[model samples]
Target: MERWLGLARSLVIYHNPATVRAWRRFYGQILRPGDLVIDVGAHVGTRTRAMRRAGARVVALEPQALFARYLRLTLPRDIVLIEAAAGGAETVARMAVSSRHPTVSSLQAAFVDAAPAAPGFGHVRWDRTEEVRMVTLDGLIARHGVPAYVKIDVEGFEIEVLSGLSRPVPMLSVEYLPGFASLTTRVIARLEELGPYRFNPVVGERSGFLWPDWRDGAAAREWLAGLPADAASGDLFARLP
Candidate 1:
């Protein structure tokens, strides 16, 4: 019962109408009808819902049991909800869970270590852990076919998630934190190996990009390094040329 309350709070915060609209506008620019999208770390499926509204076929992945149950109950029949984590390989990984604020739950211990000191994350606490199955992006591609776009928000494990992709898709985005800027650079380095991908930044949940034009990986890395240490977390949008 207590766990349900925490999950409800997360749903309320993330499924707010204005935020949903912002995500819709941003995602609409990238998704098209009949296109396939893989949403790793789908959480409560708010972004999955946004992508569905954009007319894309979505495969949503969530590792946490409680969150997975919430998604299974609310999501429509067409959306594919996978109750497992996405990583560089298939294995059982321990997930540190915050019962009161489930969105901060992560598979990376280092992320948990660094979060309390980071602004906006001081209230989060990982009170417990659960072992969950993990799957690779390439494995998902093999089973579900390659996606047109992949949205990954696996906390500090973004690099591991990207490691699974043997080839680049049309477009993809990974969550980035200024507190963990170096990890974002590692993610960029991984993406560079996959394709000649250009990048842009979308801070927080904003509908607009930071730059008027996409820049190269080196430029993007430099921009990330230049950001203030307190800059809010956001996603790095990358696309293959």
Candidate 2:
């Protein structure tokens, strides 16, 4: 019940009309009618909502029980909500849960341990844990067909999720924290192995990309490394050559 209430509060916080509009405009540029999108870490389905509004068919993945229940009650019928975490393989895993800010709950134990020292994470705590079934990106593709875009925001577990992917899709995005350069570095390396991919960054929840043009992984890595230690978190966009 406490977790449910926390999730309710998060829905109110994230469902801001102005912010949602910005995301909608950004997503609208990428998703076309009938395009399929995989929304990993679909917490409260805010991004899923934007994707649907942009005319994409969505597969919303949320592992937390409280949020998954909320998604089932609120998400559109056309959007398929999967109650599982996307990881490197099919298995059972433990998730660190933050009842106060459920969006930061993650499957990466190291990230949880390192959170206190990271900017913007000092106030949050992993107060508890829950067991969740884990599925892979490859497994998802096998079941739902390949998605045109996959938006991953599983806290710091982005690399693990990418590990499940054996091939590159047309495009994908993963959340990143400037304080956790190593995490994004590994994510970029994994993507590079699958294909020749260019990268861009969208700092925070803004509608704009950080660079005027897409850059190679090396350039992107340099850019990430140069960010100030206090730089806010954002999503990194990766696209195939």
Candidate 3:
């Protein structure tokens, strides 16, 4: 029952026509027809569908059983669906599950421990655990080939997900929480190690970049560090340019 409520909430928040259209426009600008894209933590498949509409071939990974089931039913047949989590290794991990707000459910223990004190998370709870299979980005790449874009939103596990990739793709994005700014900086450092990448932030669900031009990792870190603790959560987009 609680899981159903959470899924309903996510559908209402993300499946709306305006949000879907915004995502389609955003991906349309980045992807060419037949480009491959990987969506890590594809909860509810909103972005996956949007990328598909933009003419990209998509491979979506969702670890939550309920959400995976939902995606199987709703996502188009052409999009490849993987019912697992992306991590640094190909093993099993226990995921902290938030029955009422599954988007915040995560595999990182520290994130679960610290997020309650962060702004906009006091009401969220991880009341259950599920052992989920994990696959590395390199493994996915071996099977699906290199993607043109990879979108990751695994709560606080961004660093671990990037660790699995031995090489850089053309573009990728990871979620950032203002209160966890240091984690994002570490993510930037990881990206820098893989390739020379420029970054821009997209606050909340807005389809546009926050900067007039893509900035270096240092500039991106500086901007993230300057943000207030209560600032809106968003994705930090990185690309080779």
Candidate 4:
């Protein structure tokens, strides 16, 4: 019952017309017709639908059983839905599940360990664990061709996901919690090692970039460092320049 309520909450929060419109507008600006996109941690497929509406062919990955089943039934026939998690390797990993707040469920134990004390996460609970199949980004590229964009939102496991990619895609975005600034810094460093990339951030669920000009990694780090301790979580976007 609680799990279903959590799912309902997510659907209500993310599937509202305003949020959907924002996502469509955001993706439309970055994606061209017939471009390929990969959406990791697809959750309820709201972003997947938005990306598809932008005329991109999408492959969405969701590991949680409930959401995977939900996506399989709801996502359009054209979007490829994969019931697996993206990780540093093509192997199995244990996922921490938050029955009452599924969005915070994660594959990283360290994330589960630290999240309880985080400003906005004190109410989230990882009440159980489940083993899920994992795929590497390199493996996905080999199977699905190079995507024009990849959006990863695997809680604190962004670094592990990047570890699986040998080369950089044209663009990518990873979720960044202000409370987990160190994790995001490592993610930026990893992208820098892969290629020359500029960074920008989209705060909360808004579709617009926070900065007028994309910043280098150093500037990005400084920006992260300067955010208020209670800042809302957002995604850090990186693109080749």
Q: Whose lDDT is greatest here?
A: 3
The parts of candidate 4 lying over 4 Å away from their true place are: none
What lDDT does model 2 reach?
0.91
TM-score of each: 0.96, 0.97, 0.99, 0.98
Model 1 lDDT on a 0 to 1 scale:
0.89
- Give the range of the ten consecutive residues with the poorest summed lDDT in model 2: 11-20
For lDDT, candidate 3 versus 4, the one ahead is 3
- lDDT per residue, candidate 3, 1-241, as tens digits? 9999999998988888888899999999989999999999999888999999999999999999999999999889999999999999999999999999999999999999999999999999999999999999999999999999999999999999999999989999999999999989999999999999999999999988998899999999999999999999999999999
lDDT order of candidates, top first: 3, 4, 2, 1
Clashing residue pairs in candidate 2 are none
- Cα deviation of 134, candidate 1, in Å: 0.7
Q: Which residue runs of candidate 1 sit more than 4 Å off their true CA positions?
A: none
lDDT of 4 by residue, 33-91 (tens): 99999999999988899999999999999999999999888889999999999988899
Give the per-residue lDDT of model 1 (tens digit) for 57-119. 999999999999989998999999999998888999999988898887898888899989987
How far residue 27's Cα lies from its native spot in candidate 1, in Å, is 1.9
Q: Per-residue lDDT for 96 in model 2?
A: 92
Q: Local distance difference test, per candidate?
A: 0.89, 0.91, 0.95, 0.93
Comparing candidate 2 with candidate 4, which one achieves the higher lDDT? 4
Ranked by TM-score from best down, the candidates are 3, 4, 2, 1
**On a 0 to 100 scale, what is the lDDT of residue 172 in model 3?**
97
CA lDDT, candidate 1, residue 37: 96
Q: Point out the worst 10-residue segment of candidate 4 by lDDT.
A: 13-22
lDDT of 2 at 41: 93
